[model samples]
Target: MSFATPLPGPDGDPLVVDCDSCVVRSPGACGDCVVSVLLGPPQDVVALDDAERSALGALADSGLVPPLRLMTLDDPPTHRDAS
Candidate 1:
């Protein structure tokens, strides 16, 4: 069984996996794991525009994407001005 939608990774990149040549084949560590098969590994960061973000938000609202666990930091990292 394969995943319909791609799993989200760090920095908005989608994780992809080729189950055919996967190391964790049947009877392995991830033998009966769905999440492990679907979510392979974080590849690259996807830069999302406003429209894309809106579409993703809609998909999340409709329960297409799995629920995520978010962590909030007391002091978030500050970005330097590029001026």
Candidate 2:
């Protein structure tokens, strides 16, 4: 299966995923799945912006929405190696 295409955010920023370089590209749970956004550090908690919260609420209220799954990675892979 193919991965999900990243779309522009409300502010026109590109949401990107480099599936080709991802360590999880094969045999991982996210291999063929769509990811919404890349989050910040684990200790950081963020309140959703008004637009995001509204959109999420709308989607949740919609009957067409599917069950959601949340995944957290302790050490997420990066396309670039540290210098």
Candidate 3:
């Protein structure tokens, strides 16, 4: 099964998965991702590419933190269609 995309890091660079939070399994945040709550004080934020970052911030400032939802799949019943 597939999952959500991975988060980015400050400097727009991807961090190494040094710990458990580094993985892309979690939808919220991760240590490796640039913008996430996983990091403690002095941790970096997830800085997306220039254009994307601007849009992301604008959306947040516009009182639309999560304007819309991305792809979401409804897990099928077990022992059903695997074809």
**Winner by lDDT:** 1
lDDT of 2 by residue, 1-83 (tens): 11111122344432233434334333333322323233422223333444654454355446333211222232233312221
lDDT of each: 0.34, 0.32, 0.33
Residue 56 lDDT in model 3? 52
* TM-scores, all models, native as reference: 0.33, 0.25, 0.26
Select the stronger candidate by TM-score from 1 and 2: 1
User: How displaced is residue 50 in candidate 1, in Å?
Assistant: 0.6
Cα displacement (Å) at residue 3, model 2: 14
How displaced is residue 39 in candidate 1, in Å? 8.4
Q: Write the per-residue lDDT of candidate 1 for residues 1-83, one digit (tens) a residue.
A: 12223323344443333333333334443433333333543233224444554455555557665322111132122311111
Writing each residue's lDDT as its tens digit, candidate 3 over 4-78 gives 222234555533233233223244433222233223322332323646655554654465443211211332333
Query: Any idea what lDDT model 2 has?
Result: 0.32
Error of 3 at 23 (Å): 12
Write the candidate numbers in order of decreasing lDDT.
1, 3, 2
**lDDT at position 17, candidate 3:** 30
Error of 1 at 22 (Å): 25
